[model samples]
Target: MTSNMKTQVDDQMVLLSQYYPGIYDQLIPEQGEVVKPRRRRKKNKADGNSSMMRKRKLSDEQVNLLEQNFGNEHKLESERKDRLASELGLDPRQVAVWFQNRRARWKSKKLEEEYSKLKSQHDSTVLEKCQLESEILKLKEQLSEAEKQINSLVERSDGISSTSPCSSFSMEAMEPHFLGGFGMEGLENVFCLPENNYIHGSLDWMNI
Candidate 1:
């Protein structure tokens, strides 16, 4: 082969060697300074392959725009996927996967919000219950105090009623002594008189 042909062949071999490391290395002619084959880049199956095994990824901008335009709560992920697929020039499967992931994320966020609201409600209910319990306890104490006061008053009334008639009799006996001190000696002597005489004397004294 001419020098130009040989050079062209060598260039092709180098290109091939870069693509297939072990296979091309053995077949290619060793010349000036064997070019070490670059380490083959690992092919990302998701990006490079057209197979169904690949997981779909969505751009943040696209996802955010979708959520803004069509609410994250849009039901029917399949329908949303079809619509987004038409807009973004992506496969329906990819859109479907994206929607599935987005829905899961949205659901988790919504559940967290609901949990917070319920927790707040529960806390408020507990506080109200405690306040009500305190009010009930206060009422019970007031009722107990009122009952005690009523009992005390009843006992005092019983004592006073039972002793009042006796007290009035003793007062009548002492009244004559008070009148005698005021030059009512006859009124004092009337108390020592017979019962019938005393009644008549008391009646006369009352009339005067």
Candidate 2:
């Protein structure tokens, strides 16, 4: 077949496949036939091969211009995109895509910063809680020690009271002074006499 005629046939088949998509698959040759599948061009930029569709890196001048504009506003209007594209000698689509990617990166960075701040705050709070708990334990220990000391003092007071000289003096030791044969008169003489007179009188009474 002539190249021109083959091209015409291929074009006709492509048109037919578009009109009837279900029959396109059924029309494949069977057995050992070596048929190359038609290459379909992508209608959308995102559908292209990754290597081919990858965005070109901006030059320093282009980047500086884009960064200046980005500092003012993350989203660019269509007119602004076109103007920037003209000034930087780039396509409007490239400017729009750069802004979209930049905004996404900005949001991610902001989230990361917020997470770090919150984590720091949480750590500080936990440390403060631990310190307070330790302080409470120390206070409890001091209170326990104070109570032990008070108990010890009370026990010592009890021991001192038990061994006091006044506590050891019995009523039996004084009974003779009140119940002697001289009776009430002897008790009055014992109270009124001087030390010397009392000693002489006691000696004389003993002789009697």
Candidate 3:
């Protein structure tokens, strides 16, 4: 310690001795209060303890705000911490720790949002896949029904042609005679007619 520092320490000791008498005298060991040189301890590699001392007293509001900003915005947290530290005349490390906590909080919130969105997408995709599968099943059923109908029609047509002699004749020859048996509805239903008294095939009624 320098003369100026010794003077200051001595002045502090005198003021402090009034509150706790003999405390300063015992610790300081005064013979006119000679300034003692501080001893440096050798570092033990096995010991994890740090020589660095903690600094700065922080308020809840300041700590909370720094932490909160870190979570919401890293850039903003850094800028705010720097600005706040400057304003409060605190070390940058104090502000940095506050922002670190804030960032962790923000990361948790962001992860939650992402998880929710992924879950929503997964649910929607499942629904769409189920719907498409149902539609495919419905289309397959329709195709099966249509095939049965077509097979039935083919059998009926074959029977008609093989059993009916009228299959060889043109319809123009039988038009006048057929016109008498056909009512207004029958005429509407017929497209091609054969020259015979017996009408001998399954009619396709779907168009009518």
Q: Candidate 3, residues 1-208: lDDT per residue as tens digits?
A: 8999999898766655454334434576558867543333434554665544433346777667655655566864556767878865667776676567666777899999999999999999999999977875664455456546656766677677866653443424434443334232223212333344342323333333
Q: Pick the candidate with the highest lDDT.
A: 2
The stretch of ten residues in a row with the least summed lDDT in candidate 2 is 185-194
Using lDDT as the measure, name the better of candidate 1 and candidate 3: 1
Q: For residues 1-208, could you state the per-residue lDDT of candidate 2 as single tens digits?
A: 9999999998877755664345446677768886554555435674656757555678899999999999999889999999999999888998999999999999999999999999999999999999977875664455455545545655676678977654553324444453254323222212223346432322342233
Residue pairs that clash (backbone atoms under 3 angstroms), model 3:
67-102, 70-103, 71-102, 71-103
Among these predictions, the greatest TM-score belongs to 2
Backbone clash count for every predicted candidate, in the order shown: 0, 0, 4
Q: After superposition, how far is residue 114 of candidate 1 from its true place, in Å?
A: 1.4
lDDT of 2 at 28: 72
Candidate 2: the clashing residue pairs are none
lDDT of 3 at 85: 86
Best-to-worst order by TM-score is 2, 1, 3
lDDT of 1 by residue, 16-100 (tens): 5676656655766557656555545645766766766464556787767667645745554677668777887778886666656
